[model samples]
Target: MARTNPLQFVQQVRSEVGKVSWPTRREVMLTTVMVFIMASLTAVFFALVDMAIRGGLRGVLSLFG
Candidate 1:
């Protein structure tokens, strides 16, 4: 069996990195914008649901007071 050398490990890492297919800048920007839009939509939906629940609970408590 061949022993592993430290310098050979660095060269191996560089070679593997060179073969990776990275995303383009436009693709990254599009993905980021999509993520933001989805997040904002979810936040608005949850906020409305939370407000409805709070209002209902407030009304129920007021009846018992």
Candidate 2:
């Protein structure tokens, strides 16, 4: 592998950073809110599934007990 000098590395990093399309504050906030909302929905979905499974297990066990 080739080694880059510290100055050259810094310049390359700056050039790459300049080429990035950064999101605006509003876009970032909206995306963050969407992520939280989706995460909460997913958690609720899993919780309901878990409850259903547990209830089914208890019902089956009660029949045998």
Top TM-score model: 2
RMSD of 2: 1.2
Best model per lDDT = 2
Local distance difference test, candidate 2 = 1.00
Candidate 2's residue-wise lDDT over 1-39, tens digit each? 999999999999999999999999999999999999999
What TM-score does each of the candidates earn? 0.86, 0.89
- Taking the tens digit of each residue's C-alpha lDDT, what string does model 1 give over 1-65? 88779999899999999999999999999999999999999999999999999999999999999
In model 1, where do residues sit more than 4 Å from their true spots? 1-3
Full-model lDDT, candidate 1: 0.98
**Poorest 10 consecutive residues by lDDT, candidate 1:** 1-10
**Model 1 quality (TM-score):** 0.86
Per-candidate RMSD, Å: 1.9, 1.2
- Residue-level error in angstroms, candidate 2, position 45: 0.4
